[model samples]
Target: MKKETFLAFVALFLLTLTSVVYALEETTKTVTIAEQKADITGDRELDTILLKGVPYQDETDYLKQIFLEVSASNGTAYTIPLESGAKASFQLVDMNDDGVKDLFSSVQTGGSGGIVLSYLHSLKDNVLVDLPVPDPVEIDSHFLNGYQAEIKIKQTGKTYRFLLKDRKSYYKKLGLYYKGKLNEPTELMVNSYHSLKPITLKDGKLGLKGVQRVAGIANADTIAYVESTWAYLNGKWKLDNVKVLEKDQ
Candidate 1:
């Protein structure tokens, strides 16, 4: 479908409880609609724009399109333009309180190796901006061993805080490394977001636990996916489970 047509369909689909409108206008600056990306910046608004590119002729503004989540329902999907320098991508989530849905986007800064910056700009009208990485947790995806190291997060208020995670190297020792003298986990980080802890639940309570966890997307053909697990411990994330963590008891 044409960009304008798709934009209209999406806006109508998203207008669950609130009425929405779609507008695509041209800016004076030269824009790159070819490589646009969108993201949800923690807010619930739906915004889109083309990623900016290098310098160009004056007044050759990049094409700017404004999209609002016309309806707010779950599983609501939409296509947003990729900015000039942005890698085409989308982020879908339930941001509208009306049980509706919306989509955000992201752009790959470089090749597959470098970090691909993404955001959930629900905090405002799907506005595009640099994502802020938290400083507390450490992360690495070299060989994502969710079997022993899982990560999870929860929102405290305005900020999203790390929750719980599991030990890093227990896949070799046993199911968990609660009693073993393990080295401080080598932190794994991308965009500076650390998958330090993996949260687990064994009993009626939910806290930190060191256990191997693994889950892959179920698809006939294969597609990219995001999965991290962590366990909570001692007001922070330790590489082990809080349940059997020897020193704790």
Candidate 2:
């Protein structure tokens, strides 16, 4: 993968983990912990990789693990290692409907850069083959914490926490908590870090999508955005029309 492509994924990932929330006074909304479902990957399918190891490594190691498949049916279960400092926890999933599981897992390096790479391995001719996620740009030497697929729900007037959308088009996990009865926020702020890019689902695979940054303001005519700065709306930023912006540059 080219370096810039990797860099975009890193940004999307950081946005998900950036921890975006402001003071309640300025931000009029509250998101109670609605539902927390723990899954290794964003896919709702069960995380079977945890069972591979007899004694699961320390909890932290789980964060930096990768997976390679070795099945008797697939001639010895070995392929190429795409990333470095390999520690892994992964389950098999058929991302391309090929009827066989291609190896897929989240991985990280222990070295100074410490970049995480998620990959796929397809069983072709009874062998495991590696395939990186398809992207328009090449990813190169970018720092990342992790990657995820997510869906964010916005109630008409309530605050809600964003969940991993079973259907993914965004690069990173997007979360939201909807609380209509609580205070309404003045604006909707999307804090972007690495890996936090626009995403959508296509052909049952997670694909890059687009995003818009909107400020919380409103006039009878139209919602306004100052370059890449603000957004205006009817119910303000927290609750209003879902449109009126463009993707980040």
Candidate 3:
């Protein structure tokens, strides 16, 4: 074969191989992780709800693409996409007071911060809609002198102070503190929703409770926790209250 012809053939072969590999990476295999029977369409008929996702390369517990498949009794099938994470699960609850079950899902991020992603969806009247989850509470935290830290909840204008005398040795070793004083201005790390779940309120209505973590220098470092209560009213979510608790020693 001529040298030019042989080089062209080699290039073609390499191109074909690259295309095949790219296709495999783009392809995803989905599997059902959980299934349940519930009436979410407000039709008083059973609906088959299947939680499906694509595992991250044979990691059965970690999903890359999570979705929901609902087969309504009225001969309608719906697909809803959700965030990806590990240990994906859902609960059927009447969260919006529509008298129909809503799909509330939670996924563990499996990160050092122990963060979680939550979602809510309603399929009432054969229409699928996403219900917005409550946003994390905004906070302003900073290291203070005298081995102390302060966190202020911006929403409620509440401030909390923590004494870190017990952790003085650890903070000193990490150069975060020197002689009971902060070496420099540093802010505490606040993580997103660690857990969000439906709860029954005082007025016999369903609402959501979200818990957030505030860490010191490191994610595992102890600091405080913020809890927020929310109520769904007038077609929107309303913040009921906020609570701050110091981390147990």
Candidate 4:
């Protein structure tokens, strides 16, 4: 073989090797962000719970692939994949009142809306199953006349009105309103669960409370908050109550 051809072949091999190494570094990098010991299987023995994920390139705080790793005391291991986001964390609680501590996790999307993705899992009796989180409350919201906004909870047929006169100038500047009148019919922005956490119900059972934000025209536009309480009953999450409170502007 010619010397020039051999040198070209060597360069091509080096380039291919470099590409493969870079790909591996991007995909295979995993980090354990959180760890805890708890008796999740109801066996009275502590299990190792780990929250692991691969960080997005150049952003260590943002995970691209998040999951839960459990090393049960009964010689079993479980790996449960979860949605990717920033600031992934988990809590162990007996949410279902079944005497076994279930795993609940939340991940922040790091968006302007402050949206979060959450999950629930049961590791009881060495069986790994995902418990469903409560869905977002359906709402009908839009700009009202005279610099006001309205939100109606579809679940309970409750309506709420907000006096957004304080933001009239801001709204006018954004072409949303003109002289205290809406320029066009515009629906308010409703965001998913900004926060969901375990709360003790009045009956001493554990339940979940979620807070969702309602915005007008934009995310920062103040409107109101919709809080929903949920209870785990008969193997499903049941909505208990819905509350709509106006934002204190």
Candidate 5:
């Protein structure tokens, strides 16, 4: 082949290879940006926020580090620093009963189940401050009513009630339940309870209604246990009231 012909063929081949390389680079792209309206600052006004993250892949699954960007209506923007390895979720709740909503979110701390680590951003003087949850009692099931937060925990069959005082969550255990025959609490025992179906207190008694395991076997099917109520007397939850609907024989 002539010199000019050979040069022309080389140029065309290089152009086609570059195009393929560009297409391949575009296909494996992973970073993404998303936006949502949330009341992060505890103000009634809905603020615009952006979530910027990149896909992180591993042998089992994929996760991301979602960085939250809060934008004010007055053209001011702030970034709530979110670290790596933990996923985030956001919710607006009036935790202090101050008419304005507080920001609620959680970051996963390696548990596939049970309660993950959570964060409460309570608005202090129009600024969001990180209010850490009280240690030792992991959040099992929570019920938010106006300014009161009734939270149950894993292992224990008692409910912890917290009242919002002075723009913060305060759980004042009065040590009121002195007369009650309660079961010895065990960890991961009440895992069968439904999370979406909230267990509530009515007429001063919080009932425990769920299927119990047969002879406490690991893989055996559960049997319907009789209904029982935990009474709230004085200021603490008590298992003094037991109304057995069906005995677990």
Candidate 6:
């Protein structure tokens, strides 16, 4: 072979190698807790990424800029623009039971206590599409009503309900006291927390069990209470079977 041809071949090979190295650097990234990153696709690969920008100089500026960079395993890159003042994070789950994972994002909305801003996003045709997320009232209470697959927020004296509807979350109804009364809350009314514990049901399908802890009603000294299995259906949180778990002075 000619020496000139050999030189040309070597140059092309070097250029191709350089492009591959640059692509790898762009695809590999690190996420910090402050960013609230998650793998929204459920692909077991962290393709979704979020980066927050500095706040505006004026406090009145309601929009806080955010950059969402998605890097596919096949060397595809996409940048999405999002605006919110709160620090953002995400949870990836199959919210609609559609097998494909859905994205749930939350941002801290500061107030007397702390409020959270929620948003939902889903992947379609390899792009992130914004979906409606459940929004509860301004969370001024300490006890978060967060249960699995639901966004529950208890306000000062009232708890607002929200649930997924048609692949989007919306305000459903208000929570009632165990006695079937409009749950009128007070600063000293009650403070409760719930959890969505994973369990294997008799039907052999994986499910989440809702367990609520009624810590107090009026004050720390008030101990009379009840424990129940809660389920949200028909736009209401119904007590499956109420049992007088504890009662006292």
Residue pairs that clash (backbone atoms under 3 angstroms), model 3: none
Candidate models: Cα lDDT each: 0.32, 0.32, 0.90, 0.89, 0.43, 0.43
Question: Best candidate, lDDT-wise?
Answer: 3
Window of ten residues with lowest summed lDDT in model 5: 213-222
For model 5, what is the alpha-carbon lDDT of residue 43?
45
- Expressed as tens digits, the lDDT of each residue in 171-246 for candidate 3 is 8999998888788999999999989999988888889999999999889996998999999987788999999988
Estimate, for each residue in 147-196, the C-alpha lDDT of model 5 and write its tens digit: 33343434455554433332222212322112221123222222321111
Candidate 4, residue 16: lDDT: 100
Model 4 agreement with the true structure over 168-196: per-residue lDDT tens digits:
78888889888788788999999999899
Off by over 4 Å in 6: 1-48, 56-63, 74-76, 135-249
For all the candidates, what are their Cα RMSDs to the real structure? 18.9, 23.3, 3.5, 2.8, 16.1, 17.1
lDDT of candidate 6 at residue 175, scale 0 to 100: 41
lDDT of 2: 0.32
Q: Candidate 3: which stretches are off by over 4 Å?
A: 1-28
- Please provide, for model 1 over 1-249, each residue's C-alpha lDDT reduced to its tens digit, 9 standing for 90 to 100: 899999998887788424323321222234343332233443444334333343234423322332223222223444333444223344344323223323344444443333343343343343433322223323222223333223333222111122123333433354332434223443222332112221234532232222211121112111112233333333333332212111122
Cα lDDT tens digits, model 6, 123-210, are 6445666754322222232222231121123322433322213212211233423223223432323333222332334444333343
Candidate 5 collision pairs: none
Candidate 3: Cα lDDT at 20? 97
Which is the better candidate, 1 or 6, if ranked by lDDT? 6
Candidates ranked by TM-score: 4, 3, 5, 6, 2, 1
Top candidate (TM-score): 4
